[model samples]
Target: MEDLNEVYLSPLPDSPYVKPFRFNYTQNGKKKTWDLLEIHDSVAIIVFNITRRVMIFVKQFRPAVYYNCISRQDRESNNIDTKKYPASLGVSLEVCAGIIDKNMPVEQIAKEEVLEECGYDVKVTDLQKVLAYRSGVGVEGAVQYMFYCEVTDDMKTEQGGGVDDEIIEVVEKTIPEIEEMLQSQSILPSPPSMVYALMWFIHHKADKFRKTFERTCVECKVK
Candidate 1:
């Protein structure tokens, strides 16, 4: 994944995910114009593995994120110096998520993502709706629905690395580890929805998991 070579940039072609357009509007008798990108809505999940006292996440390389961090000259040159900025810089640790391309319920989509990206077969009813909000308001203002679900070891159906061309890595982080990342001063290469979901878990579910962990430790000591 670290190897990046012979990279080139081209005009945005026909794509299923995004389309660019210019919008002209009149407000208070004043003409206004804005550049916009129409994008698909998406679903994200905050997955907790109660059996392991850890949170499930996914790590994958994003081309947009990678492009933004590299030098403009390198970008325009159609070549990047991997020695200067490695491709690992573009890999992000994020929650299991997917675009809402299907006509099914959003909850179902979230459930499928859990299985497809994280290998957990969670029921649709188990997907508790956390909230929904607009993402990328400056460009493509698409709605993103967030959900939370808990999984046990028994729920694991496969070693999910995503389907088709997706090269996702399933990551498990303990509460303390995630807390450290949340408190770190350095920027984490993750999306806003992922940060918000982790904060939500720390506020809502961390204590419960800690209590269970403590109890299990005590039981082990007594034995």
Candidate 2:
């Protein structure tokens, strides 16, 4: 096991949205220095509409991924995997997520993200902490909090009020469809943390999730 001799080097820039901290560390006898960018706490919601047997996901273009591929191909042409071409870098389908604003609560962020990303007005309940992960390890230290949210099928009947600058598209898929995508590796563009969290929910909470869907349908008369 490699022991880390961690020490705070200096504080970097501080902003309303993020605070950057510089640190020095020794890992495996090698000295290293890096900056950790801490953003306001955030929440991600996996909204499952049981009646439709579907989970809600959002699509957006990511510039980081777009440039990553070009850089990789240029640097390692011979080592590049041709099988992984036509990569869906920009088109990432992920669970609803957003940063918690300064004064807003975590649950509020979760609800807001669900509505913004999927056009769903869902009561964010049964908030299970899925995982905390560093979104961009190499460049940024954006820690993301993920959760599972139960939503009604009619949540998307009206126009979704997403952020003004965000070009988001809502996608709903069945469990079997998600399984097929996983098998086909078509979900490569999604964040691995979210995929793993969804897998955990499927493994641990599938039965209860199904029951919730049935109850929601019964109450809404969406038969």
Candidate 3:
């Protein structure tokens, strides 16, 4: 994939959020045309609590899930209240995440986001690269790097100064709750990456999760 380099053919279209441009390129000896969308880099943190059974999630309105309602029949059968139908995509429950600002390291961004979004002061240690991918390929080209971190009880009680004007509500859920959410299709409505990250953490970090919980407890006692 790195071997293929694109050449721009025309100037990019200017937008308030991003610039979209046309490109002329060759891949595998074949000439091709492409549109390159410029976007900022971002980071996401999968923060686990001292209990190891819980994860910190944020609930917020997302424009992307506006039309994700269940059918009327399904809703009726499920006994969902029609009066409470979501006007937009209802609040999404997802891992702590934020855009990587200029001059800030990725790990720092992760730590800051956890505090801002979850009200927890997390030390960005044991950083493991979970995944990296373009978020919205069709409209935007935001590349996101995802990581995992451990959170202690003291950190949970700390007052997190979330970004001003952003309505972020922190919710902690156990592993069983996570599984229930996934099975019920009520987690975040989109961004499949979050689901994948949670699954990976549970699958690969069972032993590590236990150790992290014990260590967090010890640290809290000493502090």
Report every candidate's CA lDDT: 0.88, 0.66, 0.67
- TM-scores for all candidates: the values are 0.92, 0.67, 0.68
Better of 2 and 3 by TM-score: 3
lDDT of 2 by residue, 1-223 (tens): 0111221123445567556678899999999998776666667787788676688787776544543655544434444332353335446777788877758667767777777777777665645667777776675766788888767766665566367777767788777666666666646667776677678767866656453444456666773
Q: Clash totals for all models, in order?
A: 0, 0, 0
**Could you tell me the lDDT of residue 156 within candidate 2?**
66
RMSD in angstroms between candidate 2 and the native structure over all alpha carbons: 10.9
Best candidate according to TM-score = 1
Tens-digit per-residue lDDT, 60-124, candidate 3 = 66534532554545433434443545444455667778877668778888777887888877666
Better of 1 and 3 by TM-score: 1
> Positional deviation of 66 in candidate 1, in angstroms?
0.7
Which stretches of candidate 1 lie above 4 Å from their native place? 211-223
User: Against the correct fold, how does model 3 do in TM-score?
Assistant: 0.68
Q: Which ten residues in a row have the lowest lDDT in candidate 2?
A: 1-10
